[model samples]
Target: MGNDNDIRHGRHCVFLMHVHLVFVTKYRREVFTKEIIDDLRDIFASVCSDFEAELVEFDGEDDHVHLLVNYPPKVAVSTLVNSLKGVSSRMIRKKSYPSIRRKLWGGALWSPSYFAGSCGGAPIELIRQYIEQQQTPH
Candidate 1:
């Protein structure tokens, strides 16, 4: 249920900002396993915490991921995206995910491109439905 009550209050502002983010693997390689996705979810949650944001929902396929983030007005989407992509890549690479390591030998986990859409004005249920519709590869 979407409501104005969900809006957050900062020092001088009250706002409700949500973004749907999608990131694909470098060259669109199928590198995610259940373990990898689990690790990534944790990583992304931590990153969002650092920025005082909430990672509302997260899901992924073998080669890409979708994130529903609720953030404050002060945070720039690009900066958040950069940190999410950068920190997660570094942390994932440090771990021993053999398949991912082999495919991402060049040291880049995500492609330079990403998809970001604001969901603030849309009804929360609609946003949730859209995210649920994301295709999960077998």
Candidate 2:
């Protein structure tokens, strides 16, 4: 009842991909201040939204950040990493923390590389529930 191309395609499958990403500061300088961390949270959320992804969980100390994200199939992992790194670096240099500029020596806020791992079959919903339960009231 359908054409050859249509028949070959079968049903459309939605891919639910969860990735845990870790990004470190250049030379591990520990440059993230509380103010910078707050700003980074906002920026990361906005960027993830643009890419049709959800920033499920995010936290960082001064040197590194951990992000759990749910990404759509159309997006490339490298593209998301590059965008986040590049934009956050520029923003950190320009506004949030000028001290980082001195430390980076005109290079970058984040290291050249990142770590990404799949959360496949890892019960992400349960993890989310645990994180939510741990949240403290302000």
Candidate 3:
């Protein structure tokens, strides 16, 4: 059964916003290893925490990664993506991970563009029908 409390409660607003994000490596280079993926998971979790968001799930191959995040309404998706990429790139570089650096030429872990899609509880058509059922003026 689905959890009734899936919707998050903030001080002044309640929301259940989620975004599916996909980030590819620069030039589609295969740079990930088991250790690097582990580090990336931790880094992503930390970054999500900093933005009051939850990293619901994360997984990746050598060239790209996917993240499903539940974020508050106040946080912009772009800002979160930028921070995630920026912070992770910086942190990874600070370490001695030659595998990543050797493959990536520029000083970037992720490509310039990414994919973000919204996830919500109800379908738009269902919501539209529900809206149509609302009582109107006599």
Candidate 4:
């Protein structure tokens, strides 16, 4: 059985999927302010919604932002990340944010590489133990 609370009911299937993402500023520059982080939160949420996903949590320091996203199986994580990065970069810079664009070396706001990890599932050990305990009928 699966965790009822976490599973999302789709038209044909019940599933749960989550991924934690981290995006760092290009060259690791410490340039974000409170206002910038807030903007990023809204931007990411919007992007997630476009893909039928939810941004469960969002926060950041000066140079990096962390996101916890729950998404449907149809959405590819790479595509989602690409949109999140591309749209946010364009929107935030094109706005009246003068200091941010100047701080970046190039037109890009985020680094090319990012960190993504699967989360919100039972540990592997527990699954192994359950399998081991299963009875084999004679």
Q: Pick the candidate with the highest lDDT.
A: 1
lDDT of 3: 0.90
User: What is candidate 4's lDDT per residue for 1-119, written digit by digit as tens?
Assistant: 35688789889988899999999999998889999999999999999999999999999999999999999999999999999999999998887576676788568899999999988
Ranking by lDDT: 1, 4, 3, 2
Q: Best TM-score goes to which candidate? A: 3
11-130: candidate 1 lDDT, tens digit per residue: 999888899999999999999999999999999999999999999999999999999999998999999999999999999999969988778777899999999999767777887999
Q: For model 4, what is the alpha-carbon lDDT of residue 47?
A: 94
All models, RMSD in angstroms: 10.5, 13.1, 1.7, 1.9
RMSD of candidate 1 to the truth, in angstroms, is: 10.5
Q: Compare candidates 1 and 2 on lDDT and give the better one.
A: 1
Q: Which portions of model 1 show Cα errors greater than 4 Å?
A: 122-138
Quote the positional error of residue 131 for candidate 3 in Å. 1.9
Per-residue lDDT tens digits for candidate 3, residues 9-36, read 8899878999999999988899888888
Score candidate 3 by TM-score against the native: 0.92
lDDT of 2 at 103: 75
Q: If candidate 2 were superposed on the true structure by all CA atoms, what would the RMSD be? A: 13.1
Off by over 4 Å in 2: 1-11, 122-138
Taking all chains together, the TM-score of candidate 2 against the true structure is: 0.75
Clashing pairs in 2: none
Task: Quote the positional error of residue 35 for candidate 4 in Å.
Answer: 0.2
Q: What is the lDDT of candidate 4?
A: 0.91
